[model samples]
Structures are given as C-alpha cells and as structure tokens.
Target chain A: MIVFVSCIILFLIGLYAIVTKRNLIKIAIGFAFIEYAVNLLFALIGFKRGALAPIITQIDKPHNFVDPIPQALVLTAIVIALGTTALMLTVILRIYNRYKTFDIAEIRKLKG
Target chain B: MLFIPLLFALPLITAFVIPILGKIYKPLVWIVTTVVSFILFIIALYGVAVTQEIPMSVYKMGNWPPPLGIVMAFDSFSAFMVLMISIIVFTTSLFSLRYLSRFTGQWKFYTLFMLMTAGMMGISITGDLFNMFVFLEIAAISSYALVAFGIEGEELEASFKYMVMGEIGGLTFLLAIALIYAKTSTLNLADISNSMQVIRGTTFFWMIIGMMLFAFSIKAGLVPFHTWAPDAYPAAPAPISSL
Candidate 1:
C-alpha cells in the first residue's frame, strides 16, 4: 500500500533526475537510483505481516514463513545490477578519456 | 528434452572455449563460431520438427517438477524464436568473418556475440521467470561491451546510456516478478498463470502487469525507450550493429 506508493514515488524521482540532469555520470547514477528503488520495492512486495525467514534448518513444520522465491530472484537481480553498474562505470571512464569531460552537453559530438 | 538444454549450453560452452583457441589460432574464431551457430540452426529446425509432433514439451532440470525446479518449455512460439535466433547468429557469424577484419580483437567479438546468442536462447526457452531475467542480463551485459567494443567517445557514451536504461529495465522487471510471486507463491510461469485464475482483476495484478510491460518495452526499445537504440546501434561494429 503506502510502501508501494512510496516506491513508485522514488522511481519517479529517479526518472525526473534522468530527464532533467545534464551530467553524464549524474544521469547514470539516476538510472542506478531507479534500479535501487525497484529492488527495494521488490523486496517489500515479498514482505509478510508476521513471517519468519523462508529457511528450513530442521524438519519441524514452519509457521508463517516469508516467500523465498522473490528473495532468490532479487539476489539474482542484484548480481545483474552489479555487472551493469561496473560496465557503465567502465564506459563512463572511457568516455572521459576520449572527451575530457563528463557533461552530456559537452560530449555531443554525435549531434544530428 | 535434451535439445532444450543443448540449445543454451552449446553456445555458452563455445563462447568460453572460443576465446582460448582464438589466442592460439585467430582464424579458428570465425570457423568455430560459424559452425557452432550453423549446428544450432540445424538443431532449432529439429526442435521445430519435434514440437510439431508433440505440440508442447517440457524438460525439467534435475528431474524436479515445475513448481520446485527450473524447466525449459518448448512450443510453437519458443521453437520459432529459437529458429529465428539460430538463423540470426549463423548469418551474423558468417558475415563477421569478412566484415570484422578492420576491427582488432575479432575473437572477443565472436565470444561476446555467441554469449549474447546463448543468452537470447535461454530467455526464449526457459519457463521460469527468474531464469529469464538472468539470461536477459547475460545478453545485455554482452551487448553493452559489444557496443563499446570500439571505445570511442561517442561509443562509450552511448554504451553507458544503454547500460543505464537496460539495468533499470531489468530491475523493474524484477519488481514485477516479485509482486507476482508475493501474490501467487510460485515462480513457475505456468503455475503462476494457473493460480492467477483465482485472483484475477485486482489493482495489484494490473500494476504487476503494467510494470512488466514497461520493463519489456524498455528492453525492446519501444518508442519511449528508443533513445538508446539509435545511438547504441551506430556505436557498435557494423556487423554487430546490423545484428
């Protein structure tokens, strides 16, 4: 409910940053912010009212366990985020090397 | 049954193996990749034939059933996607042999290209939601590197922008999947769909669907997200750009 709405709000804020910002790195970070917000929202989605972690150490019957599927899925998504972040940073570094600036406006040699 | 896994595994294994052989013999990069994709294309044709008979086939990994284990399901649609991918990869590899001569590190190109192919195949055939996300990342990460293969200023800029959009897309998709899983308590697409029958037409359900649609649109470079597509394509090598 409220948490989901807040998550959407956070995503909108990131989208706003992307739309309004001019720095290349800032825009990249804005993208990362959106991802972070979404990941948070995902984890929140799997939250239970009064549930324990969805793990089984012994053979006892579990009570009110949180869903494990989204947790596993989020772990995989985080790994993906890490890879994309590293790659984005690498590309940004190369862009800086060639253009000598991080400003999106200044790096517009591809302007049509 | 076996062919489904082979469709993903063969290309992935070759992606890793090609880079090593490439260090020793350069020409083998083109030969190996081209032949592998051609074989995959043939396999995809066989997949079509097999599916035509059975109509729908499911291959569960580790012999675990759909609700617990990952499965690869092939029907007309997935088989068609596989066939399309095989054709695209085979032609791209063959063309890259002549077209990529001007580019250094041709072996790296073939390696990443095959990796992307493997990822695409994995995405198309997998019946599990999370498995699709993982494969989508594999394809995306490889493409990000491929787009920046030239390492020019514009190329790097474009690749960075593309990576940003793609990561956001992936995360949004994960959010949607999480929402679905929270409601359905299942990760299998078929299982989720079955359970969804009991809990349809809710606001939560529609939000999940909307989020998924938005994510996929970004991935596919639809109108709102098409900003990265134009810049990234031109930045990549000509052969890869065509791909």
Candidate 2:
C-alpha cells in the first residue's frame, strides 16, 4: 500500500516537473520519470505474498509460484519505454536544432 | 481468439521483413505493410462479428488456462477498438510512404508505427489487466518519441509534455494494479473480477475505478489533457503530426 502511494507521488512529481518546468530536456526527462514510475507500478502489480517463479521445476510440486503475467507485461513495458524514450530524444534534438534552445518558454513560435 | 495473436505476429513479421526488402525494392515496405494490415482488418471485422456479444471469446496463452497463462479475449467494445486500430495503422502507413520523406530515417517511422500498432492490438486483445498495462506503455512511449522525432524545440517541448502526462497515467494504473493484486492474489483480468466481485462494493472497486479512469483518461487525451497536441503536432513534420 505504501509502495503504491509512493508510485503515485513520484508520478505527480514528474507531472509537476513537466507542467511547471520550461526546459525542453527537463520536460523530456520528466516524461521519462513518469514512464519509469508507471513501469515500476506494473511490475509491482503481479507480485504475490510468497509466490515463486512460474517456471516448471524438476522436483518441486506444481505450486507456489509468482504470477508470470506481470513479468511478461513488465518486459513488454520496458521495451515500449525504450522506444518512446528514443523517439522523445530524437524529437528534442530536432527542436534544439531548429530553435537553438532547450527552453520551452522561448519556443512560442507555434502559438495560436 | 486465434486472430488476436495473429495481430501481433503479422505486423511484427511484416515490420521486420519490410525493412530488409525496402533497401532493395523501395516499394516493398508499403506493399507488405498494406497487405498485412488489410488482412488484419478483414480478420478483425470477422472477429467483431463473432464476438458480437458483451462477453466474447477468450484465448488463453500457450494452452494454459486462465490465472496461470495470459488470455486474449474480445468483447464488442474491444473488437471495435481493434477494427479502428487496424484502420489507423493502415492509413498511417499509407500516408507515411510520402509524408515521412522530410525526415532522414524512414524505417524508423515504420518500425515505431508498427510497434505501436502491435502494442495497441495487444492491449485490445489481452484479457489480463497487467498485460494491458504493458501494451499500453508500448503504445504510449512510442507515440511520445514519435512526437519528438523532429527534435525541434517545439517538438521536443510537446513530446516532453505528452510524456509527463503519459507517465502520470502509467503510474496511476500501476498503483491501481498493485492495490488489486495485493487484495485478490490473482492477476488475471477475469480472475481478478471474479475474486473482487465478493468485495465489489468496497475499497477494491474504488481502487480499480481510480486507476483505470486515470490511465484511460490520459490515453484518450480527454479535455483536460489535450494541451500537448497543438504544440507537438505542428512541431513534428506533417506526416508524424497527422499520424
């Protein structure tokens, strides 16, 4: 329970950084923070009190194992996070090239 | 049930094979991606028809039963989403063939786009909540990076903003999943529902409600969270923005 709340808190911290901050790289990092927090939460979800790995054992009885679903999901989430982080970085690099700044406040060239 | 896995496999294989052929033939990626997505759309339509009911078929992974292995099920709602996702992928690929020339890495767009498609398909197909979370992150993160591919200040800024919101949504979902797992001792969606039913009116319901709502709300980019769109979209080269 405490762990779960802390995840939420970390997420909020990222959110605050994203919303309130103006540095482009900072915002991107803030987004990464949020992504990591979410992935952590997903991994935490499949955990059990005393469950073991879901792999089939040689001698042990077919019981007492951790949920494999969350583990699988976490692997998938990590890959997804990698893809997104890479994309974000590329875009940030482009933005910097065009405007010559990583500060969000100065990049108001797209306001409507 | 079987069609669900095909969704991932077909696109994944196509995504991989197309890149190789793209270097030699040029039109290969477009042709292969289109054909695969068309097939997927046709299958998704059939799936939608078969799964017309509220509770549709569930395909357990690797022949293992629920609560042990992953399950892929489709109700009418999910089938509808699948249909739309297929269309989105198809259209995006078609558009990208011409639209992505402004950027240097053409294969990267296709890779990310297909991965995003597969991720969305996984999310729609899986009946397990945690599985959905994984797929959701896959889709969300890819889109986030896609937004910033241009690497302009505006593109980067928008991607950053989108990432922030997406991260928050992810956390909310994780917290909710953890809370549920702790209480039910089961991670399967149907199983969790079954176990939680006994405690539906209690904090369990509230926890689920809070978690899913936050995540989905962020995903849909509903009213409150739509702020990231204008900046990122225009900042990205037109094709990605359109995508």
Candidate 3:
C-alpha cells in the first residue's frame, strides 16, 4: 500500500515539474519522470509475494510465479511512451527552429 | 468469440506489413490501413450485435476454456471502448490523408497509427490485466511518437509532458498488478475478476479498484489529470492529433 502511494507521489512530482518548468526540454523531462513513476507502480503490481519467473517449464515446476500481465502492460506502455517521446522531440526541434530557444513562454507567436 | 483477438492482431499485422510495402509503394500504406480499420469497425459492431441478448461475450484464446486458458472477452464497457478506438482510428486516418502532406515520412505516421489502433483494440478486448497494460503501452507509445512527430520545440515539450504522465499511469498500473498478484496469485483478468468477486468488500478489493481507476482515468485524461492534453494535442499535426 505504501509502495503504491509512493508511485502516485512520484507521478505528482513529475506533474509538478511539467507544469512549473519554463524550458520546453525540461517540461519534456518532467513528463518522462511521470512515465517512470507509473511504470514503476505497474511493475510492483506484477511482483509476486515470493514467486519466481513467470515462465512455465517442465523439469522445474513453477510455483508462486509473478503476474505476466503487468510486464506485458509495461512493454506496451514503454512503446507508447517511446512513440510519444519521439514525437515530442520532433515538435521541439521544429519549435526550436522557428523560435530561437527552448523556452515555452517566448515561443507562443500563435496566440489567438 | 475467439475472433475478438483478431481485432488486435489484424491491425498489428497491417502496421508491420504496410510499412514494409510502403518502402516499395507509398500509396499502399493508406489503403491497407483503411481497409483494416474498416474490417475491425465492422467486426466490433458485429460482436455487439451478436451479444445483444447476452450479458457478456467471451473468447478463449488458442481454444483454451475459461478459468483455465487465456481469455479475450468483452462486455458492454469493452465493446464501447472498441467502438471508440476504431472510429477514432478511422476518422484520424481520413484526417491524415490531407494533413500529413506537410510531413515527409508518410509511412512512419501510418505505422504508428496502426500500432496505436492495435494497442487500443488489444486493451479493449483482453481478459488479462497485464495484457491490458501491454495494449495500453502500444496505444500510448504510438501516441507519444505521434505527439512528437513534427519535432518542433512545443511539440517536443508536449510529447515529453504527455510521456511523463503516461509513464506514471503505467507504473501505477504495474503496482496494482503486483499487489493483486500478492493477494490472488493470478493475472488473467477473468480469473482475477472471479477471484475479486469473492472478496469484494475487503481492503484489498478497494486497493484493486483504486489502482485501476487511477490508471485508466489518467489514460482517458479526465479534467484534473488532463493538463498535458491541450498542449500535446495542439502541438501534434492535425491528423496525428486526430489519430
């Protein structure tokens, strides 16, 4: 329970950084932090009380195996994060090219 | 029932196949993806129709029976989500046709798009929590890359922001899975649900609910947790945004 709460806390910290940071790159870093927190929470979820690897083999019977779902979920989530991160980087590059800096406040030339 | 898994599989196959084909012919990418999306949309609706009278639909994977083998099933909630995923995917593809011209890598866009579609479909149909996470990641990673597609500073910022929040959600979900494992010793969702049904009122049960609710809500991007969306959505190319 404490572990779960800590994960949430880590998530909040990342959120704070993303929200408060002025540098675009820093904000992106904040977002990365948030992803780490959530993935950590999930990994903890898959951990067994006293289990071994989730793989099932014949010679050695597996007992108390951890959940494979979270690991699977993590794989997918990581991919999604990777895609998002790549996309973000692309946008940041464009933004940097158009503007002179990675600062968010100065680059809003598109205001309605 | 088993055809349910195919909804996830088909698009994934398409995601991989089209990119390879796109290396040879560019136009092949859109057609293949569009057709795949159309098929999935039809199939999802069909699934709902077939289950009109029943309470739920279950598809055991690899001919394995329920409670013993892996399951891919859906109730009303999942069916609705499937509908959401496919419609969004189709509309996004339509939107992409015009909007993606500004971008150079047409094939890359479609690849991520199909991957996102497949991931969402996988999440909506799977009867295992871990599989749900995997699918969630597939959708997420694609979305992340999509967000950063333009490589503009603002887009990168948005992508990073989105990535941070998304990762947190993934971690929380992982924690939940771990806790549940500690208690129930299983990860197949149906079995988990069945097991959960027995201990509905315990502190542990609430723990499960808390983890899932927190994770999905973040993914869905509801009000308080929705800060990254406005930035990311606008930063993304219109078609990518739609995708």
Assess each model's interface with DockQ, reporting 2 decimals per model. 0.60, 0.47, 0.29
Which is superior by DockQ, 1 or 2?
A: 1
Off by over 4 Å in 3: A1-112, B53-55, B197-204
Report lDDT (Cα) of residue B202, candidate 1: 84
Candidate 2 error regions (>4 Å): A1-16, A28-83, B52-55, B95-104, B149-153, B235-243
lDDT, candidate 1, residue A26?
A: 81
TM-score for predicted model 2 compared with the true structure: 0.80
Each model's TM-score?
0.92, 0.80, 0.75
Give the interface RMSD of each candidate.
Answer: 1.9, 3.5, 4.7
TM-score of chain A of 2: 0.91
Residue runs of model 1 more than 4 Å from their true location after superposition: A60-64
For DockQ, the strongest prediction is 1
What alpha-carbon RMSD in Å does predicted model 3 have with respect to the real structure?
A: 4.4
lDDT of 1 by residue, B138-242 (tens): 998999999999877778878877877887788788777777777887789899989988878888778888999899999999998888898888899877776
Between prediction 2 and prediction 3, the one with superior DockQ is 2
Give residue B158's error in model 3 in angstroms. Answer: 1.2
lDDT of 1 by residue, A1-112 (tens): 8988898898888888887898877877787778778788778877899898887867776578876766676677778788887878788888888988888778875642
